[model samples]
Every structure is written in C-alpha cells, then in structure tokens.
Target: MDVAEILSHHILDHHWGYSLGGVELPITTHTVTLLSVSVIMLIGLYWISKGGASTLKRLLTAGAEEYVTFIRDGMVLPNMGTEGKSFLPYFCTLFLFILLTNLAGLIPNMKTATSNISVNAALALCSGGLIVYCGLKFHGIIGFLKGFIPSGTPGWLVPLIFPLEVISLIIKVCVLALRLFANMLAGHMVLISLLLMIFIIGQLSAVAGVGAAIPAMGLEIFMTCLELLVAFLQAYVFTLLTAIFAGSVIHTH
Candidate 1:
C-alpha cells in the first residue's frame, strides 16, 4: 500500500456493515470501541460489587470509590453547589466513559472511539443539551435566554449582545468537541508516525534504522505512559468543563 493508504488506515474510521434498503448502517471501529468501553465499565462495576477480600479486588474498589468521590466533591459540588448532587450520576458516567474510551486506544488491536470527530461532537452535544435543559428548567425559556445578555447593557447594544451570547454558547460546545477530537487525533498520529519512522529509515539503510528502532521503541513506550496520564487528564478536563457550563446555565450569570 502507498503512504496515503497507510496513514488513512491508521487515522480514519473503518466500517463493517451490510447495506439495507440502500442505506448502510455502519458498525465502525469506533462503535466496537464504545461497546468495549461499556463492557469494561460493567466489569469494573462487577468488581466493585464483588466486595472481595483479595488485594486486587480491594484495590479496584478503592480506586473506583476514590474517583467517584473526587468527581462528586471536587468537580460537581464545587461548581454546582448543592444543586450538583442531582447530576452525580451523569458526571460519573461521563468521566468513566471518556476515561475508558481514551484508555482503550492504548490496548493492542483496539481503536479509540473518542478519536472519532462524530463521537466527540455527539458528546459535546449531550453536554450542551444538558446545560440548556438545566437553564430552561431553572428559568423559563425567556429567562434562560436573557441570562446570556450581560446585566445593565445599553438598550442600543441589545441586538449585538443577544446574538453574541448565543454565538458564544454555540462556540463553547464546538470548542469542547474540537478540543477533544484534536487531542486524541494528534496523539495517535504522533505515535503512528514515530513507529513508521523506523520502517522508513530501514528502507534506506537496514542496519542504521534497526539500531535506531531500539531507541524509537523505547520512546514509544514512554509515550504510552504519558498517553495513559493524558487519558485520565482529558477525561477530567471534559467532565470539569461540562460541570462548569451546567452550573453557569442553571444559575443566572
């Protein structure tokens, strides 16, 4: 295969589906990764429920419990105050879902669902929807929309302010989607390029490239560790931002 095909294979989504009524319902690698994430989460839940006295089981439960508490107190409560408790379930699910999907990319032969732009966009939409829903629930449509306008604005600037605020809200959701999609896509591309370098160099001088591959392999391993940390960090950042946005909409200003 040519370079373009190889790169596309690594970067693009793959579909596995049959045509039905001339409309294909794709079961892409991202779909499989998402399913895997759900199963992994279920397994984590099972481990927590087992309440086993084994060291590994206890450690898993402890970690899960700690993460839940962290998201609750550190993220949800601080941002949403007493009202945040209502969203604990959503916060946990979002964090764990993102975390699992992010980590899944590191596993051999497994794809990253969040790397898909559509998936990231969908996630951002969900968060944006929640923010809007909360705003509308707390304040009627008119009131909720009015919160977008700055207080004490000049009447002459009313038209500009309203449109700007609405645009800002849309931009927030778009930023959330692009930030996540870009990060995941860039990281994977970097990893793939690094590995590909070994072969590219080997094509010219087999001995030199073989020697270089050793250190390259080591760097790749280091990157794997860093990627693992990034997986957690990105998940936390997304969850934190969603909480902040939700809180902002739920309360005026």
Candidate 2:
C-alpha cells in the first residue's frame, strides 16, 4: 500500500481528538506524531552536544557552527545591520529546530512537525510577534502607531490609509502562517499520494507496479531532499522578513 493509503487507514482506525487537560484541542494525528518526533530529536541534539571533544561533540559542533555562520552571514547581517548580530542566536535556534523537524519526517515511521498547521502557526506567530515587539520597543508607542501613516499622505487620506495599513500588517502575519503551513502540508500529501499510486498499480500487474514503484521511490527521495532545503529556506525567510519589518520601524525610512 502507498503511504497515503496507510495514513488514511490509520486515521480511520483511530478516533482522533484535539484536546488536552480536559480542554478541547485541535487534536490531529500529524501534530501529535510530529511533536513526539521533535521532542526526541531535540533530546538527541542536546545529548550529543553535552560532552567535551568526542566524535558526537565534533559532529554537533560542526553542524551548529555551519548553521550559525550560514544564518549570520547569509541572512541576518545583511538585512538588519550591526544590530542583527544580537539576533543571531534566536535565528540560529529557529533554523536548526525547523531543519531538524523537516529532516525527521524522512525517516521511516517518523512524522514531520512542519507538516502540521498548529506547529507552523505557532512558529509564524513567534516570528510575527517578535516583529511587533521589537517595533514597539525600538520606536516607542507613538512612533510605532505612527508607522502606519505614510510619509507624504495628506491629512484627509490619513484616516483611510491608517486603517488600511493596519489591516495590511495583520495580513502579513496571516500570510506567513499560511505559507509555511500549506507548503509543508502539501508536500507531504503529494509524496504520500504518489506512494499510494505505486501500491494500487502494483496490485494489478507485478511488472507494471514495480516499474511505477521505482520512479515513485526516486521522486520521494528527491522530495525528502527538497524538504530539507525548504526547512532552512523557510526559517531564513521568516527571520529575514521579521528583521526587514523591524528595521523599517526602527529606521522609519
């Protein structure tokens, strides 16, 4: 059977709920599965990084060093100026977390956190909220509020422009959340569905099925690599966009 068929059967077999602690929740198989995997990966990372110079130590150090340098040189510094240096740790953490989460899904019997809407939404909110917080902190309440008003608008247009600008800002947050959630979710769905095709076709004829399965397997492998790229790209994009918005508020140009 294809991965999608298996997932569909599993979902049908298990009653799902979105709740915890007696409170209703957005209970999804994907969310629970991915979160468990993420926790385990995080623990593994922590354990590997805990000791002095050993093989695991060197591996962890090299991985972290490369990731940190990538985010610092490629993403933050160019966009946010010298002040961006202070944000390096936060960006690096976000990037590694997402990258690990994305890669975990490629493992047999593992789930991807980025494929869950709740997970992606939480990540988006963190980045978006930081943008708002930094904006207010650097610019103060009045300056932050005044940011909505464009430089050359007439007094009469301020009333219309202000609300529109505020709404647009709100839309940016929504788009950020939706973009990540949709991309990750869609990629997984496509891969699973393709696997399912191989299973169904194989049932009809052994040779035909095997032929189809070979290409499908190759495509899945390619997608696994693509997801790795996406994991880092989304992390960098989120942080870079946040810095751009924050910088606009601070510099007001």
Candidate 3:
C-alpha cells in the first residue's frame, strides 16, 4: 500500500481546522504523541540529574553521555574539525529529535512523525540551510560558489562541471530528506501489512491465524529493534553528511 493510505489508516487525527489566515491546519495524532515523548525525555534528563551519582543513575547517564560524545568525536569532529564544535548543539538537537520521533512509533497507538515527508523535509532544509549559511559565513558568496567546482578540473570542463556540481549539491539535500522519510514510512507500512496478514489469516481459522501471528509478532519485535538502530544511524548519517558538506565548503577540494 502507498505511504499516504497506510499512514491515514493508522494515524488517528485529533482535528482539522483553518487558521485565521485561512491556512489549513491539522492537529495530527502524532503531534500529541510527540508531546508525550518530549515529556518522557525530559523526565529522563531529570532522573539523571536527581540520581546524584548513584550507580544505576551513573550508568544511565554514562550511556547517554557516551552516545553524545561518540557523535561529537567520531562524526562531527572528524569532518568539521575544531570549528565543528560550534555546530554541535544544532546537530545534537537534530539527532535527539529524530531519534525520539522514531522511537515514539514503536509505542502502541502512537504515530511516527518521521514517517511524514513534510517533517523530514523540514529537517533536511534546516540542516542544508545551516550548511549554506556556515559556508557563506566562512567563505564569502563568491568563495562559496567557487567551492562547488572541484579544484584541478580543466577549464573546458568548468562549464559542465559547475552545473553538475550544483545539481549534485542540491541532490544531497533531497536524498537526506527522502532517506529518512522513506525508511520510516516503509518500516511502518511493512508492520501494518504484517498485522493485516495476521488478522486475515486468523479470520480464516483460529489455529492457522495463531500460527501466522507468532512469526509476524516476532518479526515486528525484530523490526522494532532495527528501528531503534535506524533512528540513531540516520541521525548520525545526517549530521555527519552535514559536517562533510560544510567542511567541503570551508576547505574546498
């Protein structure tokens, strides 16, 4: 089934309305779901703060700290260097936001915001715009444009390579947006289809349906774990790519 149909089937809508300016607004099921996730994350932070260096609390905090440090040291610093430290806050927020959004979907009755293209595109635009802004700030407009064309290309190739380079640059942003959207959307669709299959089989015969359900339930559990990994991996990939893009502009090859 198509993503829209699948999402519409599962994503409960709270309400719809027109704004004062006549813009349509959807109070999506996922929005409320995300509010709860935000509260949970905040509570986690509070727990860490209040645990006061207890062994379990320290372990939880250490795990969280390690993940953050890994992203900074292994992903961001390698590409953007010491100057990359300045961008850490933005990248960290992006990672946590997407991670939480992905995790929210695993909960019963919750919609995945990352499954929505608009949401993923907004994130891509935010990251891409930051790259462009940093590029411009680091190397004036002329320099930023010049950074697009690879050094040592023949003069004749400049005419072709320049436009190709620009297109490639734009494609990077498009890929970033589509990758996360497609992954989340596809995962949810698979889950829904699996569930539907179990229901269909169960209606045919109780025994057979239960038999079908066992494997499907197992797969769903596996996918849930996979989704958690994807959540962190995608965030890392996005931030790492952004750092690489920004680095390329700052220190053009």
Candidate 4:
C-alpha cells in the first residue's frame, strides 16, 4: 500500500454500523478514541480526588492542581476576568480532553479523534454557542447584535462593517476547529512520512533500507518529542483562543 493509504488508515475515522430492525447505529474510530479520552479524564480526576498516601499519588495530584491553576490564571482569568470563573470547568475540561486525545494518537496503533474535522467542528460549535450565549446573556438581544458593530463606525459604514464583524466572529471559531485539526493531523503525517521512507527505500535494496533506517529512526524520535510539545501547545492555544473570543463578547471593551 502507498503511504497515503497507510496514513489514511491511521488518521481517518473508521465506522462500523449495526442494524436492529430498521434502525442503524454507527460507531467510528473517533467515537472510540473520544470515549477513551473521556474515560481517562474521569479516571485521572477520580485519582486526584480520592487522594492517596503514596508519593506517586501526591505528584499526580500536584500536577493536576498545576494544570488547573495554569488554565485559570494563565488562560481564563486573563481573558474573561471574573466572568470567566463560571466557565473554568468548561475550559479546563476542554484542555484536558484535547490533551488526552492528542496524546492518545501518539500511542502505537491508536487513532486520534481530533484529526477529524467533524470532531473539531463539533467542539467549535460548542464554544461558539457559549460565546453567543454569553453575549446575549449579558447584553440582551439588541445589545448583542449591536456588539457586532464597532462602537465608532458611521451609519453607512456600519452596514459594511457589521457583516464583516459577524464573519470575523465566525472565522475565529472556524480557526479554533481547523487549528487543532491541522496541527495534530499534520504532525502525525510527517512522522508517518519519515518512517515510510525507510520502508520505501528498503524496497530498492536491503542494504540501502538498512542505511536509511538510522536517520529515519532518529528523525522519528525527534518528531515524536516535538509532537509531544505540540500536543500540549495545541490544547493551550485552543483554550486560550476560546477564552479570548468569549471574553470579547462578554466585556466588549
């Protein structure tokens, strides 16, 4: 099989359908990975909550606290201020869920759900909905609509600027979805391409393939380490952007 096909198998969502009477249920690899991520988060939180006397448990709890603090002080509060406190659970959950999903793909033979645009779009929609809700909740319907128009635009200019502002709002959320999807998907594809080269070269000459293995393996390790950093970075960026966007509508200052 070509490298593209191999990459697709690892990155694309695989679906299985079951029919009972006329009803059909479809479960995809993304479904599995998302569920797995959820379970891991639940278990991690439970472990942290049900504290143990062991050193490992203490370290784990400490790390979890740091994550929460970082998201609160670093991402949420800075963007949304006191209004953000209510959404801490959501932003924290988003970060952890995406972090686990990205990290899961690094595991041998496991799929990354966020690699799918649909999954990321679903997440984007959730954040977008919250943004709109917050705008309306604080400003009321007319005020929320007015927020789209800049405070200083002239009447004739507003007609043009208003649509652009709405479009910009939409593009921001779209970026949230695409940013994570592209980063995770591209990182994995680069890794696969590097590894694939060793095998492709192997087909030419056994000795040449062996020669290729050293650099390919080395690059693969380096890429994996880089991807590990990216996994965390993408999660942080998504949460930070979400907070900023939500903050925009919440404060409008």
Best by lDDT: 4
* Stretch of 10 with least lDDT, candidate 1: 1-10
> What residue pairs are clashing in model 3?
none
Alpha carbon lDDT at 6, candidate 3:
55
State candidate 2's TM-score.
Answer: 0.80
Each model's lDDT comes to 0.87, 0.72, 0.79, 0.90
Instruction: Compute the lDDT for candidate 3.
Output: 0.79
What C-alpha RMSD separates each model from the true structure? Answer: 2.0, 3.7, 3.5, 1.6
Model 2 RMSD vs true structure: 3.7
The TM-scores of all predictions, comma-separated, are 0.92, 0.80, 0.83, 0.94
On lDDT, the stronger of 1 and 3 is 1
lDDT (10s digit) by residue, model 4, range 143-199? 999999878789989989989999999999999999999999999899999989999
Cα shift from native, residue 243, model 2 (Å)? 2.6
Clash-forming residue pairs, model 4: none
Error of 2 at 225 (Å): 2.8
lDDT of 3 by residue, 1-253 (tens): 2445654677434454546577666566766766777787788767875756578988988877887798799877888888778888787777777888888888787888887777788889998898888889888899888988888999999999999988987889988989988888888777777777787788889899999999999988887788778877777777788778877766776
> Ten residues in a row with the worst lDDT in model 2?
9-18
Scored against the true structure, residue 211 in model 1 reaches a CA lDDT of: 88
Clashing pairs in 2: 17-27, 18-25, 18-26, 18-27, 19-25
Question: Model 4: what TM-score?
Answer: 0.94
